[model samples]
Target chain A: MTRITRDQLLARLRQEIPETTPWEVADWLRDGKEITLIDIREHEEWVQGHVPGARHVSRGFLELQIEMVQPDREAPIVLYCAGGVRSLLAAHNLQELGYTNVYSMAGGFSAWINAGFEFEEPRFLTPAQRERYARHLIMPDIGEAGQIKLLDSKVLLIGAGGLGSPAALYLAAAGVGTLGIVDFDRVDRTNLQRQILHSESEIGELKVESAIRRLHDLNSDIEIKGHPVALSSENALDILREYDIVLNGSDNFPTRYLVNDACHMLGIPLVDASIFMFEGQVTVYQPANPAKGIEGGPCYRCLYPDPPPPGEVPSCAEAGVFGVLPGIIGAIQAVEAIKLIVGIGEPLVGRLLMYDALDQSFRTLNVQRDPNCPLCGDNPTVTELIDYEQFCGLPPRS
Target chain B: MSTIYIPTPLRRLTNKQSRVQVEAATVREALQALDEAFPGIGERLLDANGEVKRFINVFVNDDNIHTLQGLDTPLNPNDKISIVPAMAGGTVKA
Candidate 1:
């Protein structure tokens, strides 16, 4: 028996499977048709460049992961590789597995690149940025493109206390383009334990000022905007409007509810985290109609219809918290924010994650949109930001 | 018999017992069993109409009870139930 050469195998597979051109696929994508494009290249090849919105299932795991990528066998499937040979073979295999609408791109990703078709490639990184984010640029999950998204994205943090401290540091070091920090408090000796952005030397300095200094020291290439005023109904929307996403690390219920309402009104994604004692919770509330592929989900109000009655929940000062708790939860918030900006992987939208440091366990729960929610519900009542301090039974900011 | 997993926030009502075993064929009955075992725990989970509270999510195995059959969803002895509450506070330090 004679063994078939690679060319002969490619010819055989091409005869059995339909072939799509790079231009045609690009056109189909632009037309907004529901199609699933799978990249059958190695991890390194995919990290270099590939078509946007293409599901990556390397040739080695093509069969094993195809079901997870495209559950519907009838969905239009297009497979591509570095050249076209591997995709042709992979397309044939998919067809053998009962996939009806499978096609192999004739010239694969190389053809797409050569034709100048709309494809996603890691952005060109400066030598300094490359060095700073060496670990990030190498990871298949967050390559040059993700890092670029981080550098180009704008994030607003509501506080510079415990939760905000770690979130701001990681986000700044990650090279987020513009970091807008809103805080009016001064660093105190009590904050030294967990507020990593401030040090003992800066005890009396403004929280946002100290934060800006620390973040600048970490990554001077990024821009830092400090809002020294309190976030109120009058200025929350205007201040939050400029940022792509918001991270609510505010230490009070008034600010938490205000940030949620403002982000909801402005249609900005929010990464919310709260810590009390050894337990912490982190979740993302994306805009109503999340980016394509993400499920449309509920906002913070949908989870807790209204803020807990004043004093119903104790503050960290009343009930001491583990110093490292915010560090863990804030890091998760940073991860969720980056995922939302880069439009990659499954975000925590509509899901709440609860962490208990005492028991060392994490529980995730599904959050559903309530048609009766006061803010994001169909019968929506809270149309604009209200006086959150009054709403939370706190004296109005003088 | 099914095992119900309680979340941290509601653990105070359950005597800090993370897992509780009960015998019930449906989710509603399971909640009733949980209430009997740990008094007043079901009140936090169910409203006056006996419907699961809007802020609470109950999952049978990996499927949310709302997507299944709500309180009527049938359960097997080997199935695991998880009850989670919506987290809503960040003022850990005043």
Candidate 2:
């Protein structure tokens, strides 16, 4: 049997496969029809820009990963590449794999842009920002649009210690427009082991102050708001209202519950992370926004209804955390926060990511909304923020 | 026998052992075995109704038991079961 050349294969597949113009696909998306658009490009091309909401499966792994992405073979699937060639081949492969309604975009991404169809690209990047985020701008996922979203987004971090250190650094470096840090504690000598934001000279300085200085140094363009006051019921809502999302880096149960309730009430996404010893966990608590295409998902309260009795759970100090544990978890929180702001990729709204550094393993558990949750449940009894310190068995703040 | 990997928070209950080998055919029995070897372990995992607690997740060979048969999910020998609790700690230091 004679093996066909690449050109011959392309010609043969083109003859049988149907092609859809960029305008037609754009109209389908605009009309809110249920269709799956896939980008079969390399990672470099994908990060530069892609059709918003289009799932990316590189040409090399299309066969391996397509089943997981589009399980229903009968679903309408559109594939596009830089040019039309790669996606045409990918569409042919999908058809061969029994995908009944597969179509290749006639002119690929460039043609889509030429036709003035809505495509996602990095826009409004200044020379400095473009240079600073060159790597991100080049990425199809975090290109100009995603970078702009990061710059336009506001994120409040609950604590400026362990988890907050890495999260603040990365978010600021990633060019998050505004960062609000809530912390009243001073940087202690012990914090130097894990809190990278503060230096030895800054010991005894307020954490929020140190964080602001360090984060500014990292990215002078972004604004850093240092709230050097302890977050309490009196000011939690007011402080949180200014931000689009909240990151819970507080260690105590009271603050955890407080942040959760505030974010849930405000209907803002919360990227929550925790680390103790060699273990860490990260999850995003994004309440449903039907208008934004986000399905209603569980909040933190849905996972752990009530805080564990104060003594039942140990803090990082008591358990003696691995120095780098928060770095790992906090970085993940930054990733989730960026993804949420950019509206790209799957956020961890209904999933729990557990990492055990000692074993070098990561596990994600499926989390669902609890109808009985007091805060976010179907019959939520917690319409207002209460005294979380008392609820978590901690002494009321003086 | 299935190997159960314990999370750090629960290591104290298991005497700091990260992984424990237990002879059991189901997830429930494995929990019972863990409790037998280490007292009070079952209480943390199951509720008053003997159901897996809402906050706890038990995975059998990387597949969530919820998607499987819940507590009755059959366990084959050499399977790995991971018991993870809901982690909520966020403070830098206590």
Candidate 3:
């Protein structure tokens, strides 16, 4: 008997999949019965053109500010991005999260443009605006509302290096309402490759401040809040609650648990992602649903009942991460956050996605809730926040 | 007699022995037997009222005892039991 290669098996699986098209959605929209068309592309993309009268919320702000921005949760909603990849993904995300009538413009705005629709001319920028937004406007996915979402979003980044870099940059360019950074360390030369939030000139400066300076320069509309103090048992939950979404980009376990617990208790959906060398994992943690049986969603404690003994696992400093690993995973975290905020897509609440950069392979492992999890168990024992450092058996900084 | 395998963190109480032999018909009995030999090791394994800590996981060979009867998980003679602390990493930055 011959063994089938992985590619052959994947191709067979792809063949079995059904097609998703926009004409069905276009027809649905044209009928004008009871649906809202969402132009998921950037504001510049929307300004230069969009489906007329379509809501102009960008993907970045949509997820973080959904409850505030989209008051009618029951409204039939459809989303479209540049080429439809992001929009299709966003539509599937919305469907997964209990949105009944979500749809994606199958071909997205590119297709919309191809259909010879009229568009608002791209706006001219002042010299300062040009200097600040030169890189962002060039990218179709992150033009105007995308940049505005960056300005409007309040994202809490647990780490300033690696994964936090791209997440912050994209959020800034997308115009997230506010960007909150939590990092106690100073910029080290080693962080430049992946921690794009910091610059070589800013070495030895606080990571949060460095990120703030660069982000402010990038987009003055964005509010950058810096928390230079380390996240600890005393302040983790409170700090996390202030932000619309918490991005876990830290390189340690204790902080991950703290962030998870805070998000779970606060009912603020968490956009979680992690990187280890060449491999990375991304997931959304929604505390509202326990039936999904996802550990992290219930709380980090649900997944990791206890922290590995100190030194049992090597740190990123010791294990050496691929320079680009955080970039990929961090960007996905931003996507999940935006999806959650806008209430547009299925927000990875129950699924844990893993990426192996070496083979360019992605896999997901089934995560089950610990029936006896202290945080979200049938008879939960942990009711309030405990000192994360104490929970992890770490000493407080002097 | 069955052997109990202890993970890295709790091994200091076991004299750094990965595996130690103890005689007991049930998991609770085996833990008691092990506790008699090593005084403080049981505290880490069992809480104040002798309930297992939520973080410490016990396995009879490959199957987790938590799915069975937890500390009361029955163990036949010659069975292998292993205790491991869950891998908890990532959270907080200093």
TM-score (0 to 1) for chain A, all models? Answer: 0.69, 0.69, 0.62
Off by over 4 Å in 2: A1-123, B43-80, B88-94
Give the TM-score of each candidate. 0.68, 0.71, 0.54
Whole-model Cα lDDT per candidate? Answer: 0.84, 0.86, 0.70
lDDT of 1 at B80: 87
Write the residue-wise lDDT of candidate 1 on A57-168 in tens digits: 8999999989999989899999999888899989988998999999999988989989987778745678899999999999988988888989999999988988898999
TM-score of chain B of 2: 0.93
Clashes (backbone N, CA, C under 3 Å), per candidate, total 4, 13, 42
Model 1, residue A329: C-alpha shift (Å): 1.2
Q: Which candidate has the top score in lDDT?
A: 2
Best by DockQ: 2
Q: State residue A173's C-alpha deviation in candidate 1, in Å.
A: 1.3
Candidate 1: which stretches are off by over 4 Å? A1-124, A289-295, A390-398, B9-15, B24-75, B78-81, B86-94
Pick the winner on lDDT between candidates 2 and 3.
2
Interface RMSD of each: 3.9, 3.5, 5.5
Task: Please report the TM-score between candidate 2 and the true structure.
Answer: 0.71
For model 3, what fraction of the real interface contacts is kept? Answer: 0.25
Q: How are the candidates ranked when ordered by lDDT, highest leading? A: 2, 1, 3
Lowest lDDT sum, 10 consecutive residues, model 2 chain A, at A306-315
Alpha-carbon DockQ of candidate 2: 0.24
